[model samples]
Structures are given as C-alpha cells and as structure tokens.
Target: MQAVTFQAPGEVRVEERPEPDLLARDDAIVNVDATGVCGSDLHIYHGRVAIEPGFTLGHEFVGTVVAAGDGVTQVTEGDRVLGCYCSACGNCFFCRRGDFHQCDDGRVFGHGKTLGSLQGAQAERVLVPHANLTLRRVPEEMSDDAALFAGDVMGTGWHAVDQAGVRAGEAVAVLGLGPVGLCAVQAAKAAGAATIVGIDSVEDRLEAAEAFGARPVHLMEDEPRAAVKDATDGRGVDAGIDAVGHPDALELACRLTRKAGTVAAIGVYAERVQIHMGVVWIKALTLKSGQANVIGHVDRVLAMMAGGLLDPTPLVTHHMRLADAPEAYAVYDRREALKIVMTP
Candidate 1:
C-alpha cells in the first residue's frame, strides 16, 4: 500500500507502506477511497503539530469496509463508510453523557502519540478503532467528496452553531471563511439564523459565504464589529463562532456577540493567550471552546447534508491522487485550495 508521510517541516511524501489490519476487537480495516486535506493535516505539514516522521497523515476519510472485527456490529464488510476523525469508547464516562469528544479512551487518528498513536487514513487502507462508534455508512446517493466531510469538517461546523444555540431567526457571525467557517455559515442558515455574517480576508471565501446566504465582511478591509452591529441594529449578533483557530479571530468573536449571547470557539487553541475577561464579565457572555464533538454530531450532519440544507460540495476546490499528496499539501498550505480530496 502507499500512504502520505510527513518527511519534515513543510514537506510530505507519498511512499510505500504496509496495509493496516484489525488491531482490536472493535477495529475494522477500511480500504480508503477518498480522504481530505484538512486544516489539522496542514498543522502537521507545517510542523506545528509534532507528529512522527513517516506516519500516515490525514483523518478525514470515506471508503469501503474491507474487513471488520466481530465486535463491530454497527457496520459490516463491504459497507461504504465514512469515519469520524477520532474514535471514542462508548462505555467511557464522557461518552455516557453524550460528550464523546472528551471520552476518556478516545483516540485521534493521524495525530501520533499526543493524540492516540493511530495511523492516518491518507492511504490505501486505514484501521478504524471502535468501529461501531466511529464508522458510519455513507448514504448511497451522496458523493464521496461530500460524505467525507460528515465525519469532520461539517460536523465541527454544525457544532459551532449548535453549541452557540443559534435560534431560528437569530443573527450569527462566523469568523474565518475556511472550509469550517464556510460550513458554519451554511449550518447557521440551516439552523434558521435570520442574519449570518461571514468574516474573512479572502475574496473567494467571502464570495462563497455570500452564496451560502451570509453577508460577507472582509476581516481587514472591513470592520467586522461594525458590520455585525449594523446588521443587528447595534446589539451585535446573538451568537458568534470562531473557526479560524487564531487568537485574533477568537477575540473578535467575543467582541461581536451581543450582551448575554454565546460564543462558540470551535477553533483549535493549544497555547496560553490573553483574553479580555473584563469585557466578558461585563457582557455576561457565555464562552465555550474546544474541538467539536464530531462523533456526537456526525449523524446529524450527514442527515443535513443528505437533505440539501447544508451543501458543502462547492467547498471542494481541488482534487488530487493520493500519490500527489506532496503537491496537495503545498497547495493547501498556500491557502490556494478550500478542500482537497485525495483518492487512492
């Protein structure tokens, strides 16, 4: 088999690798048909996330189940499946409370030891752990590119909206305009937000958000705070989402949310950063931050995608063969592509 491997900072390669097999009773071996170049994968490519060199390097995947362990009863051999980026042990304390993202025994694929030491899916095959809770059957009519987002990007986008409690007809602001941010715009629309403000510096991304029913506001050229106020009659939006994973975007999200409103920081935050606690304290804001509960939200996201209310098909701006992962990483790092799907 062949897989994408991180050779060093700013470099990735496609090379021969041994195929994965069942490693646990709840594991399944999937012959990957399609995998995505996600923002998290970019972190690895940039060497920001310290992953072992030569480790398989992707998490978003859609494929057919070639084999399954006996304990994996939710799916069977030959099932076309999509896997959540991380696996959760259903019996864990957090899992019992529906907070599978924080499960005590969770394992993230492709993130190396810091996550779970599980190899990635950007290859000919991947081993899915806790298959009954991690692998989902793809809807027969859904395209592979679209189905792949259900387990990761789209689910996280939905989580941003859901955690913020974007009520019908309420106003919402989504920071960033990357795949996750654009998906958040669509999720806000699907959740019946009357006003959706999309903030980004990229013109193409702004245009894409506009097409998704959001009012695009350029982050640098435009005043996002003023834009949110102008749209909401000076009260700010009911909810705001930080999808950029940058401290600046997170701060802006806090500033743009109305008094007593909610701000969901779905972006990745790994280091200590200053936050204006005074503003939050005075506004009575509710701040929620963390990775998305992907396992918990995957089914809902898939249903929304199938219903056409949340379409991410337009987000796929590049398609490459698995062997072209080197170039794929470069294009994504340059911010030239929105979503890149690689097929084996």
Candidate 2:
C-alpha cells in the first residue's frame, strides 16, 4: 500500500507502506477509495501539529470494507463506508453522556501518536478501530465526494450550527468562507435561518457563500458588522460562528452576535489566544468552543445529504491521484483548491 506521509514542515510524500491488518476484535480494514485533503490536514502540513515523519496524514475518507472482525456487526466486508475523523469507545465516560468528541480513549485518524497513534486513511488501505462507532455506511446514491464530507468538514459545519442552537428563521453569521465556512452556510440554511452573513476576503469564497444563500460580506472591502446589522435590522445575528480559529475572527464573531446569543468557535485552535471578556460579560453571551462532535452528528448529516438538503459537491474543487499528494499539499497551501479529493 502507498500512504501519504508527513516528511517535514511544508512537505508530504506518498510512500510505499505495509498493508494494515485487524489487530482488535472490533477493528476493520478498509480499501480507501477516496480521501480528502482537509483544512485540518493543512495544520499538519504547516508544521503546526507535531506529527512524526512517515506518519500517514489524512482523515476524511470514503472507502469499501475489505475485511472486518467478528465483533464488527454494523458493517461487514464489501460495505461502502465513511470513517469519522476520530474514533471513540462507545462505553467510555464521555460516550455514555453522548459526548463522543470528549471520549477518554478517543483517537483521531491521521493525527500522530499524541492523538492515539492511529495511522491516517490517506492511502490504499488503512486500519479502523471501533468500527461500529467510527464507520457508517455511505448511502447508495451518495457520491464519493459528498459522502466524504459527512465524516469531517460538513459534520463540523453542522456542529457549529447545532451547537449554537440555531432555530428556524433565526439569523447567523459565519466568519470565514473556506470549505467549512461555506458548509456552515448551507447548514444554517437547512436549519431555516432566515438571514446568513458570510464574511471572508477571498472573492471566490465570498461568491461561493452567496451561492449557498448567504449574504456575503468581504472582510476587507465590506464592513462585516454593518452588513450583518443591515441584514438583521440593526440587531446582530442570533448566533455567530468563528470558523477561522484566529483571535481576530473570534472577537468579530462575538461582536457580530446579538446580546445573550451564542458564539460557536468550530475552527481548530491549539494555542492560547486572547479575546475581550468584557464584551462577552456585557452581552451575557454563551461561549462554546472545541473540536466538533462529528461522531454524534454523522447520521443526521448523512440523512440531510441523502434528502438533498445539504450538498458539498460544489466544494470539491480539485481531484488528484494519491501519488500526487506532494503537489496536492502545495496546491492547498497556496489556497488554490477548496476541498481536494484524492483517489488511490
């Protein structure tokens, strides 16, 4: 098997690797049909995340099961499935509370040893742990490109909206226009948000958000606060989502949300960043920030996709072969692609 591995900061290589085999009764081996280059992958690519050299470096994947242990009953060999970005023990403390994202023994695929030493799915074949909790069958009508998002990006987007408790006809402002940001727009729309403001500086992304039924506001050229207010009748949005994970973006999301509203920071943040507490205190805001609970939301997300309410096909900007991962990373780093799907 050939896997995309991290060589160093700003470098990745597709190297020949050993085939993965089941090591646990609940484990399964998947023949990866398509894998995604996600924004989270970019964190490792930029050396922000410490991953060992030769560590497989992808998480979002759609594939067919080649083999499964006797304990794996939800899916069997020959099933087309999508693997969640992280695996969780179904009986753990957090899992029992329906908080699988905080499972004590959780492992994120493609992230290195610190995250459970689980090798990634960006290869021809990969091992999957906790198969029942981590893998879900892809709908027969769902395309590979669309199914892949259910495990990660689209799931995160749904989480942002869900965590914020966006109600029907409520207003939301998604502060970023990347793949996740755009997906957030769609999710908000599906949730019946009457007004959506998408803030980003990139022209293409802004356009993409508009196509998804959001009022696009340029981060630089356009006044996001003013635009949001105009869209909300001078009141800020019911919820604000900070999808950029930057300090400035977080602050802006807080500022854009109405008083006593919620702010969901769904983007990846590893370091301590400062935000104005006085503003939050004055507004009596409810702040929620962390990794998305994709495991908890995958079924609902897939159902939405199958019902045609959520479509990520337009987000698939590039498709390349597994062997060309080096160039793929470069293209993603250059912001030349939104969601890059690679086939083995």
Alpha-carbon local distance difference test for all models: 0.93, 0.95
For candidate 1, write residues 200-303 as lDDT tens digits.
Answer: 99999999999999999999899888889899999999998999888888888889999999999998988998778887889999999899999999988999
Off by over 4 Å in 1: none
| Candidate with maximal lDDT | 2
Backbone Cα, N, C clashes tallied per candidate: 0, 0
Residue pairs with backbone atoms closer than 3 Å in model 1 (clashes)? none
Weakest lDDT window of 10 consecutive positions for candidate 1: 244-253
User: What does candidate 2's lDDT look like per residue over 24-123, in tens digits?
Assistant: 9999999999999998898999889999999998999999999999999999999999999999999988999989999999999999999999999999
Off by over 4 Å in 2: none
User: How close is every model to the real structure, measured as TM-score?
Assistant: 0.99, 0.99
In model 1, the Cα lDDT at residue 110 comes to: 89
> After superposition on all CA atoms, how large is the RMSD of candidate 1?
0.8
